[model samples]
Target: MDSSLIQRGRDRGYLHADEVMAAFPHAEDDIASLDEFYLTLEEQGIEIRDEEESDEHPVPETPPSLLGRRLGSHAHRADPDDSLSSVS
Candidate 1:
């Protein structure tokens, strides 16, 4: 799986250690931890998906879009934002 996608899943509470390990088999090659994943997402400006309302783990529908992922019961990728990392 894509790092960005894995990051989003973790952010959305969908990533367990095994899930993360399974999602990105190559994470051991570079990424060190889930926190590191968040750090990279912050540095790379990737949007983390929300799971409160969205279950699909939707990604930004558009390329390089800044709208962030809008996940209703129907999840749809719009654009990404830096705000996701700050959420509690």
Candidate 2:
């Protein structure tokens, strides 16, 4: 089972641990692991929300792009003729 799908389901309030286990019986062990992982994240003060509560939290905005500046920056690559073998 893809953890991301489980996460998305949780995000959308459509899936939970029981549903995941039923859908992917082979992932039983992983369900416990995922629960523990979520717990750890909560312990560290990260917020994990169920679908009902997801709407209450605002999604973070994307950071401004640096691509323009990066593209404008100059860089130099070594020329093949500059190699010691070429000189010799």
Candidate 1 lDDT, 31-56, residue by residue in tens: 66656766665566554534353455
The TM-scores of all predictions, comma-separated, are: 0.26, 0.28
In model 2, what is the error at residue 16, expressed in angstroms? 10
Tens-digit lDDT track for model 2 on 1-88? 3557546655664444444455556555667766765565455454544547644757755555864555454646567668676654
RMSD of 2: 14.2
Query: Among these predicted structures, which one has the highest TM-score?
Result: 2
